[model samples]
Target: MASFATRHIARGTTIRASDCGSLADRGSSLKVEALLGATDQQLRTSGIDYTITAPSFFMQNFISFFTDDYKSGTIYQPVGEEKIGWVDVRDIAAVNAEVLLNPGRYKGRELTITGGESLSYTEAIAIMNERLGATTQFVSITDEAAVEAVSAAQFPEFIIDVMISLNHSIRQGHAEKTTNTVQEVTGRPPITFRQFVDDHRTTWL
Candidate 1:
């Protein structure tokens, strides 16, 4: 485990995974901290610097994990009417690169990064349908059914539980907030969800 290995690390900065602000944020953060807490503590004990990055749901999820469902113009989830601050992964990388290159500058900092706009799945799919000219749909499901569906695939219980909690959090409006950390840290506006969809139109086509 990466967490266990943190104990052996004598120097160098660490980047911890945190969550965007929302109702569904706390449960996952606790689970992540359990895995990474040892590393966090070890880094502190050794006087090594560390920073945490809290990013919202990634814009690339549709292309990466949900392509099969997207092919049928469907984005299935339990996220109800809540707007999500969908983040572009590229900007996450840029911030990480900046921190990695100049670790001392961002020492002990925890940044909540986002793509700068919040939109529900319905709005996002509409944008995709318009720009990509593909009639993508956001098909919301009940929390129990979504969890059961993932569980039926033989996923681990913990993974399924987390997925359910994440969806519940979104439905509760936890991930609806946006932040300027990306622009502030990288000195440029974070890519919008539309930009990400436009840039990757060929993937869906």
Candidate 2:
């Protein structure tokens, strides 16, 4: 978010994300942690932005979990009944690069980015199975069950519960979708999940 602002906002230079696959919603602070965890040199190369983008329901992923999650053979995504906005890294990168190179057209403004489809955890997993031949291999784990499951692990129970809460939020539709954000900036239609799978499924298989 701030990246878009600084290059376009302050420096009057071109800016682009290059990818959003790693981006998460605001509350999912894992992104912040990862960014902060970066070495000083990394930040210097990346350049700091004024403000980061926040999602009403930022469901970038549901895996900001502790080690115990791996034991379950299935990862319970930390999303609830929300239709959060999700942007693919490719789409974000493509748009940002385009806007930055043509700053005269898109500068000093916030752009909402997404894969243009709001997918719930179940819906999202199902698509992977259908299009990419990847089994989601997960069963819905209750918060209490998850808390119990992780109690024996190294992580504190409180942290386990919090992650569960994130999943609950995604199921609830807190994360909405606005496909136009990508279209508005790029002047082209955003790619769909099917296309994403076709392009990358080979690696997974």
Candidate 3:
């Protein structure tokens, strides 16, 4: 069996039996590669036979993880000014299905899936607000304040750190590039941010 892993998980680390549950732990026989954002070097050293890399932040975060912030009309994060290529979860799912079904075809390849455009939080919020007919705003917070807010919300410290780092990565332009891997793999263009917001309008409302 094969399993997915994140880019943050160190290379050569044993697949934890408790990670995604027992079915995910196939011991030495389990195939792991990019999973989420694993670098080429990390995939090469992961000891997995088939490797597929997906690099991009998901646009679904606004609905799932940041719903409260979005609904409350203020998105609090540390990503300032930099633009990010936020791919839709549907597109990512399609690409993952294709890679899993055609393992040999996607093996040893890094698929940098992204939306049709790169947008900063400000730009993305505008699109979403316009699409939803709401007036949500994006507020840029400092890293320390973000961490403190997360902590006050009862999130684990490690996860708080990850959240801060993720915002830092975005603020530094780490996800500014857009790719057509989703179209190439799924045989269709990825959903744009506006399109995504439109499709999930009810959720945002």
The TM-score of predicted model 1 comes to: 0.80
Runs of candidate 3 with Cα error greater than 4 angstroms are: 1-42, 46-48
- CA lDDT of every candidate: 0.71, 0.48, 0.67
TM-score of each: 0.80, 0.54, 0.78
Winner by lDDT between candidate 2 and candidate 1:
1
Tens-place lDDT digits, model 1, residues 85-203: 88898998888888777777787776767778899989988888888788778888887888778888999998876666566656666677888888888999999888898899898
lDDT, model 1, position 32: 38
lDDT of 2 by residue, 25-129 (tens): 333434332332243224334655322222223222332231233333345643444454555566766766766577666533445566677665567556656
RMSD of each: 5.4, 9.4, 9.2
Query: CA shift at 202, candidate 2, in angstroms?
Result: 2.7
lDDT by residue (1-205, candidate 3, tens digit) is 9997652221121111232211112232213321222344455677675544444678898888878888898998888888888888788778778777777776566556678899998999999888888898888888888878878889987667556655655665556777787889888998999888888889978
Clashing pairs in 3: none
Q: Could you tell me how far off, in angstroms, the CA of residue 185 lies in candidate 3 after the best superposition?
A: 0.7
After the best TM-score superposition of candidate 1, give how far the Cα of residue 3 lies from its true spot, in angstroms: 20
Of the candidates shown, which would achieve the greatest lDDT relative to the real structure? 1
Would you give me the overall lDDT of model 1? 0.71
